[model samples]
Target chain A: MQLKPGGIAATIGALAAGLVALPAAAQQQQQDAPSVAPGNAYDQSASDVDALVADSAVLYYQEDGGRVRAVEAETGLAWTGADGLAVSGRFTYDSLTGATPNGATRARYDQDFIGPLPAGGHLPAADTRTGASGAYTAPAGTLPVDPHFKDQRKAGDLGLTLPARAGFRLSLGGNASWESDYTSWSWRVGLAKDLFDKNTTLSLGYNYEHDESKPITGIPMPLGSMGDPAIGKQRIKRVDSLVLGITQVLTPAWLVQFNWSTGNSRGYHTDPYKLVTLTDRDSGDPFFYVYESRPRRRIRNSLFLASKLALGSYVTDATARWYHDSWGITAWTFGLSEHLPAGRSAYVEPLVRYYHQSKADFFRNYLLLDEPTPTYVSADSRLGAFGAWTFGLKGGVHLSDRVELYGSAQRYVQNGKRFYRDAPGTMAKVDLFAGSRSTSLVAGLRYHLR
Target chain B: MSVDRRLALLALTAGTLALAACAHDGAAPHLKLGARPWERDVLARKSMQLAVEPALLAFDDHTYFSKEAAAGGRGFDGGGCGCN
Candidate 1:
């Protein structure tokens, strides 16, 4: 269900109430549920010994309507030195293929979507990464889908943690990623300290990111005609972020975390390949398509609170988040999960998360020929107000004393709220809120050895 | 940084500092503090980690970036990937 303007506050209130009752719930569960705690071995940190936690997973995501399928594989290893120094590294590879919906909506007449000419291709190049030329024709009354959307990415990360003092720790991290049309390099540093016998922890972190984008068809001017000459070959964007995290153990069986993060992104923020169609006022026929435009700078902030309660052999987790940005968008997210031990060596977890977002300042379904051009405008559905839910189940088994294997399946559904009341021509009659249905599956193994 | 971001960052710093000071002053005391060394056994379970599934969490962050318009509430995410 969509949340009203004041609904975010209500959600926060409910979360606070849940937080207040967690201890009570824990006491009740402990009394009724059989204690399944393993004979007295505590967290790895309790023992001053070198330790390692390594894991690997592969995920497959598919969206219906023959649009946007992805395969992502990741592996990571974290090592904790007996003397309090930690080191970690990770690698990820992602492959995305299949068609994706263009911002343009369906019309009564067939529409031919063309691309920029390639180095050796014919007049219209349909796919940029592949350097292929062909016009994708959207059949009359069908939503436009760009069948040539494809890309692969490789990314790596490294981190280090040092014990600066008796109760303070410092961390440093870096990341690099490469794609056909984009690349990014980022770094971060954080400092944390433990208080109250390590029962409470506070951390502060800062991240800096730099990105370069070279659109497949060459970068174009914002809101410029698709037939216009290319404006440049590449653009740059930079984002600076600050994060504060607080983790407090409310009781022996419960812990709560609060985090506040803010980020500012400046520079080119437009999606060069995405376009908005301007339809004829009467026929609803496509008159022209132009690149969508967005503000160059964005400042964002969020407040997050999460609580985990361990009751006997079961665990319950609840989380809430409120977010806002300079572009006149606000969002709220709530998540709940329960873990039940199935047997001596296995368990299953079910989780549900709901998200709601308000529209951006300049979001529009489509532009009209007669209407004057606004300073900023976009047809990207991602900027529109919408609600989404994710339902998932995960099961895991301990293969041995130090080996575990797990898998999970999840489904995501999104529905755009009807935010606009007027549109020219048949555009007003078309169903513009065609939210996506996607499912993902993950399988992985983890091993622990000292 | 933009002026708004600068102000926000300043506020984050002030908030962090305030919380840290409150904790340093022994505001909670041992009685109200969390698990003791002996009580740590149950709380130490892997399931109790803030992120029970780090891999899944990472995957979701990337997946949702394309579909949603919100980010930054859990932890620091080093930016990577050209999200469609």
Candidate 2:
């Protein structure tokens, strides 16, 4: 069932009551509380105490059923005339499919560094790092394939501020992903500078990535005669990217941001794990085959814009993005979000996003068996053009001064244009391929300590 | 050339600038150090300090970005298995 606006309101009311009751409980047990410094306790107002408590204890959790799960914890401590520091970290686990035979499982870890701006010290910058790994088994009865596939990825980044005279900050990062026979590595560095006395921020960045894989041997061909295969074949690919952007604060409550990026890729871009089939000219029968090798080059550009508005008691945010690539693909995305207070301490946000993309340059329905072909024919679904829409609802409830509960659910649907194929002469028949529409639900709770 | 000396010099410069700025701004009346009006009641409420921002977004994006093979979310695009 869908959660209507009234239901959201009721949930918020309950959260508000829960938040307000905590102070009452603490007051009832005040006699048991620890002693406070004589003048320090009275020097600060009640609101200062509340702010201190809120800033010290913060936790977050989210779970997407059978797809993803995550938890985060953070704590901050502030002293008079000294910089405030907050330490936070997150962990996530995801299982793409149900406990099916071909399901995949992935896990990730992240840490963030946050600190207050030094006196006139510009905005505080943060650093983050994440590592992930996953393994998946091919679906049953699909093709003669290996039992399973495994991969691991790790990334690290640093965000730092530059001197006001330099008018820029720098962000540097590196990443690596490896499998049994393949490895990918990437590095990126970016700079951002504010102008017009913080009214506008401009950023520029560059990135380079490389991938190398060792070809597998000793596999029996499905259609062709088996032969003693040559092993130790190596494949390599490289990608380079440059991005530029600017953000402007139109007003105290309004902002606009724009970004443009260009990317160039070269080398072996074909997937060795997937293949396509073509019907024979003489027999008119389909034969499954694999691509030997193919090298490709691609260029891509993307732009994104976002704005946020505050209305009386609610905040509204909107974002739009466009992307174009030399592979003959163009795509657009739009998103909207609204956050409303449920009660004194809790709030709920509803979000929706829509995305659409055009087809690739070499995407094909099928290939004729008799036709002389290029070096590659792939059925990788991501290369196809498609459109998808998602609707989601999430609620956040504060259970105590340092604890929170939250849950969210989303429904997604995709047009069956690129992935789903329609056989000739079948008006109502459609083939549901490996990629299809799906739905997810998530919920989790978190607690923090000072 | 020693690391300690370099750090000491850096600290001296930073301290000098900080002290100078504080001296110039110290004469100004202290803005009451407390939560803003909108934050006053919210902070007093329990769960106001709960951490939920990045974790929720990270999980949701991870699931869909990998499963649907869509792009965006938490930077770095394309790396894992192309199963989606």
Candidate 3:
């Protein structure tokens, strides 16, 4: 049964009372009862890792209309040491191949790479070293992409948790990732405390991340004229974040959590490989292409709330979140999942999610050459106003008390307007949602070793 | 409204919601012996845990971060890709 808003309020009140009243009605006080621990580094959980666990997963993703395809595999290991200390490590590898939009309009003629190919070129394109080397030479009236585009990445993570005095837990985590032209490192620390007989957990966390990128053609000059100077050095970006969260057990079968996070990032935010086309104001004909530019600094904040409700053998998980950034973009996300038992050792879960976002103030699909140039402009579809929905199903089989197998499949679709603004001129029409549909499949296994 | 103003308003609204969700009666509800334990039993199951699938969930987070414009809410902010 779902709890009505009023009923939830009443239940919350009861929980407050239960904290102080020390509910003697608790029949078993099951040791396995879920703790009000912060679930992640941002949300600290108070419980100690008690077992050695290993998990592995493989994921396959394909975007509709052949936009992008990716395959990924990940593994994780966690073990508890003496004195309530836990250590964990994870590794992941991702291989992505296929075409991604170049933010350029369909060309009226087949355009060759702007420059010549490099010796021992890895890709098939003749213009291997040029900015367009790997780019697809679009046929007239077709979107351009580098059909031979490919990228691979590998990442590793390590974490440690230490239980301190007075029911406080401290956690530290670090990560490093490497790709052909990009490298990143990050670290985080968090502290969590349990109060009111573990009914409530409060946590505070901080994170820092550093990234370096040296694209195939180096850093393109934003909005630069043809033959502009390029920065051949790697670009750096950094982010700092702080989060505050709380998890509460509202009742024997109800759990709720809330988190608030603020983040600040500095350095180049532009996409080196992505460019937007300039169209003639009168004819809407493509003229030239220039790389996008964004503000050097960004500040973002988000609020998240999640709840879990148990009904007999079934449980429902729900989450809602709101996010905003300095770029004048706002977003809302909602998700729900229901878990039901199919047999003694098997269970199935169905999930649904919805997301909506407002466009950035400077978002543009294509620039009109006659119009005044903006200091910041991006034709990236991700920054445009859009709505997306995802639906999926997941199931798991407990092969034994020590081993479990799980798998999931999900489909996502996004919808948005193709044109950024209504201009009186006849513009080249494009299908903004051409790459909107994607399917993701995941298979995983978890093993617990005592 | 300006971005700063919108941010302030959102922060205020979020604060209000948190307070409301946590609102409780000043007095604790005293429980007598022997209330039903079925609900507790269900909640104690591993499947009922909020983070039941750690590895898969982490993978999902990365996938969305790469594809979406918004990121960061639950916690760790490790940079993985240049364009992401």
Candidate 4:
């Protein structure tokens, strides 16, 4: 072979390298460079190449007053090849059922609505009315609801992560979701680079999403009467998002991340089933209930900061966010989580989060019948001023070397303040607050296939 | 308390946290501290990650997005859910 002389030279070089230790500068460079060990071709242990890592979870959520009930099952699978290439995919299925608010506050008198929803736009066709008549009534002092709310959603995402030139890792992913009334698809690309002795990372990502809505009840013109004929059958919404993030390790036991995200959405943003009621200026009696209206464009921005601290075997994470949008909505969120060890193979985490948001510019509790309807108006409670809190506990235990099981439960409570000016006398005693209380229960198993 | 006093208190609390964060950062951001490279085994633990539970984080994001007026603080991938 031609390597006879080169082989001898390489043998001598190996001996020289073994006889003397590397210089301090060389050692530092070696420390900063990423490891490419024989056993870690995929950046993990050799056994990971032979094992399929999968995570499966099931969650149930229910809101108070039977507002909404949902169950979801999700699974994620990952594979890493010896060539340092990785592929990951996720699948999710969820079924939702129960009554949902139709955006009208409870008043002193009973309210009647048409079809399975409170909107008159959902009226059955003349030919099918005999077999599929749908209507419901809200009792006195009760919030109007759509009792026939039911839907199933299936979603999936696939991603690839691979190393790029100049010490950067690039990621490409796409996601799609389908439901009876709505569908969405998105593609995202991301780039991340490590620096400062591998103690800091900078990342940038961009995503574009397209969504379509085909309401079974038909799409009505903005602010139009409930019984008006549908303006169209389908509407489309699109969003473009960009995110910049930085992760830094202050000490061996502390890590912090800062992220700034911005997005712009155009097209449909209003809920088709929601309605707003108009009351007479003199008697406060309900005069008309019409579909809601919203602007065609929205721009949003947020700043997020999170930190994790390791104290011995215990770990704690704290996060805070500031959010704002062109719709005149501002929000703040804070969260804290602590992971404590219980035994050799088990741990528990207690978490708490707080959120508060101000009312949107066009949010109206109720429109006045005597006055002209504003260009943009909505009674959806989510657009109003509200504060929320979440408390949760999660625990996990290793059933065996290859299996881990975990479960969590969390309670969410929201409180809002509703206000209106120049209301009629009869509306004085009505409860206008719109809020919700819900509970979430989740359980999951992670298995390593060999 | 008055609004001014409350604002002052908030500022003070934030300053205190900032100092604490910098105590190990050596007066500036992203600066290495006393811990040696080999001593970072604890930081390698999964629990030490910013968001340890990915699944739980996703669920929380979805829940808050549906409940609140403003969304999109973390990940940019989210579908338009017909939720109230």
Candidate 5:
């Protein structure tokens, strides 16, 4: 039987659920053993049972944006003994100003014959065009540019887990978010199991997500016939995912892990807020309007591997990932972390990461104002190929047995290749549609009540 | 049961009895039994182990989720969201 996206997700979810229940069965069998001495056995049983109780922890965080403030709070508990279970959950609030709530748009062309022709060379008659008379007579050149829209959003999540025994554990979780114009929900479940005397662990997981958005009322519709008008009002989308993984503890001081995951998404994938121009074939004039509804589906797959090793007094962690999707996008990522002790009371960790992605299938540097084209074309930056790098340092210091303090700082930059550049032949003239650079800092303290 | 099979079983049983008789010839050791090695250290450091630092792990989760492609310390690729 062929496995659809939803089917794969469901299968993985079922596997994870089964893994979570295995530990309870093992614990039951262990409890049936006969006792040797009354007092000693009773005391040993008390300690063993007490060790299975769950441990608890809490944390708070704040994220900074130029005009937006984002915060998160989380609480977690884990049982350590026979059952070996863990559960963690978190809630987040995000607020943004000068944020573009409305989505962005993009369009592309196979080839533009923008010759250095005189202004009076050719023009199209206004009456022959369907909408927006200006589009029929406007020059073939591109528009100057417009300011991006602003918007806001808030989101939250919760996660639960059961630890590995004989090397097995189960994980499950969900998240939801809401904005002025849109709402989304996602859920996931997973199971991990170890084999070969705890040397190799395998995991399988699945996720499902749904998103919907409503257009603002009273906004005037664009004057164009290139894209579907139905997209201007309401939007709906869905995605299902599946993941599989393997981990190996090669040695006492070395570990390696590998993972592969796939996702299939369907429905409205284009942003409604952006617009594209079409060019008249005969007159070279351009048309100005919005390209709205386009139904599309995507398939994404990824491979990731990471390793950790102890180097003298410090530990080093390294990871690499490769990703590809049906949208004609491919990407790679590399990251590293090093931890060093800062005297007896403190420790420091420095981290660096780099990422790069290729452009989407329909990505275009620019679109003409007046043009008639096929159904598929987009310029969304999220679909485009891009590269980014981030560097950060984190440190922690112990004040006493009950209290500790820690903090981190990070800087990020997006490479120019992420944007389009003018090239020869079939190479379209592309430019940076938009880009951002920022830094983040966090600090917090932990207190033990027990 | 066959005669030979019964005789083999009886001989095995007799040998087990002989071993048991020899074991009873010795008395239990006089030295006192104590806590397991790991248990002793755990009890000695009891005061330092009680604090649950939930927040620190939460911060690590968020940071790693947004920045790293491979997560789950044990080697799994996490889902990609709009958080980054």
Candidate 6:
């Protein structure tokens, strides 16, 4: 199905109508169970139907200066079976287009690029060119960008939950995502048990993922050197992670959750499309660019904690996370949100989050020709020391007994750390702190179908 | 303290709290069986959930994962994307 806004609503209405009757009959037959409150059929059915929710959302994301624009549509369906089983599925389609920064600094003259060469062919050297209308200028003192960047991706997920016993739940899931240049498949298993009268829950989970990336154009020459073979090939990366979590009901109005996780990734971790500018060792003048490289293995760990408290008609949530990686990066994240209800069918939530991270050991904006090339180096800004802030607001209204509508907007900004500098006296005086900003908006409709 | 020590301390604290609760009397039935009838409606409100909306939270997490350098500390983890 197209699942456009109108189509999604119509489809949901029909599907919900068909599915609602089965669950009601099942619940009525199961009213003999002690847990089913007598004469509270609506509440019992509501609780049962609440487990099944269908969602459709459209998202728009934009970066500064008309840079990258991404539009995505996502749909999800989750239903609980009568035999202590639940299944859920999700699918998302993303279309991305626009200019993206190419790791080169602003130059005194315009820069031009040529050809998407086939495998084993080198990228044409950057140069200035003349057009019919005279010199074609790309402008100076601004970040270099590849103007013809575009891609599309489709991702799907499936999950199953089974209540194996009185107090234990088991979950299994798999995911597949495919893009023009990349494909990934992952599987996960999780188990959870309730203790202390179901107030304390402990869970463990593990996941494994395998990914293959084949750059649409071709893999650049090794070490980013010129005149090298730009082979068209597929690179692989794999990750395995484990998680342990605990949730406790502290009081009638408060609850807390904690999670500890560890993971490791191996294989190609570099940005295939990014490169580092090489500068003259002594003069600090621009020399050339080379493809970025990164370590083959990465180990990471994180601890996260979250708490929720209810006060009258308002609910508040707070979370903190600490993360560290073998790449010599450490990060801290904190967030808070407050949900306030308006009347009986509407709610508004305001959220704010702050994140700060240390740079990887091999991160560099530009490499000096005088220094020996490291085994691993990258110019990707995400690997550098930076701080990010996100502000968001979301509101939802109940449109009908089975449908709810919600929309959200979020703004994110990342600024480089002030303490970072190239080395005392480099040839170029590049400003590494030029930050990036983006905004995202999402509109969604949810259906509680029995 | 080191991260390992802190983790140990937190685990110990959680163990102690659970044991202490187990030892205590039925002084707070509301914390055990269920909430009082007067507060049931409020407790059952959809907005009271930590995630509130699961699909929306999942989408937000995916966006952050693509843009940020961190991932996975929540209850469950899976899936990989080429957003980077």
Q: What's the TM-score of chain A alone for every prediction?
A: 0.87, 0.62, 0.84, 0.85, 0.66, 0.83
Q: Which candidate comes out best when scored by lDDT? A: 1
As a whole number from 0 to 100, the lDDT of residue A139 in candidate 1 is 88
Proportion of true inter-chain contacts also present in candidate 1: 0.61
Q: Compute each candidate's TM-score over C-alphas.
A: 0.85, 0.59, 0.82, 0.82, 0.60, 0.82
Query: Model 2 Cα displacement at A426 (Å)?
Result: 8.2
Q: Global lDDT of each model?
A: 0.76, 0.45, 0.69, 0.73, 0.47, 0.69
lDDT preference between candidates 1 and 4, better one: 1
For DockQ, the strongest prediction is 1
Model 2 alpha-carbon drift over 4 Å, by segment: A1-166, A177-183, A212-234, A280-285, A292-295, A397-407, A418-434, A441-450, B1-52, B60-84
lDDT per residue for candidate 3 within A356-386, as digits (tens), equals 8898898887888878778998878788888
Instruction: Estimate the lDDT of model 1.
Output: 0.76
Select the stronger candidate by lDDT from 1 and 6.
1
lDDT of 2 by residue, A276-304 (tens): 44534444333434332333776666666
Clashing pairs in 1: none
| TM-score computed on alpha carbons, candidate 2 | 0.59
Off by over 4 Å in 1: A1-49, A117-122, A126-134, A418-421, B1-31
**Better model by DockQ: candidate 3 vs candidate 6:** 6
In angstroms, the error of model 6 at A412 is: 0.9
lDDT for A180 in candidate 5 is: 57
Which portions of model 5 miss their true places by more than 4 Å? A1-82, A99-152, A163-167, A217-233, A277-289, A292-295, A369-371, A417-433, A447-450, B1-84
> Residue A13 in candidate 4 has what lDDT?
52
lDDT of 5 by residue, A1-450 (tens): 112446434534543443333334223323543222221111112122113222222222222233222333333333334455544445544433222211122223321211111123343222211111112111122222221222344556677676555566788888887665567788888988755444455678888888775533211233234322232446667888777666655444555666666777787555544444444333333333444333368776677777766544465778788777676777887888776654444556688988777876666533554345546665444455567787887655445434445555567665545233333222233233433355555555444443
Model 1: per-residue Cα lDDT at residue A123: 66
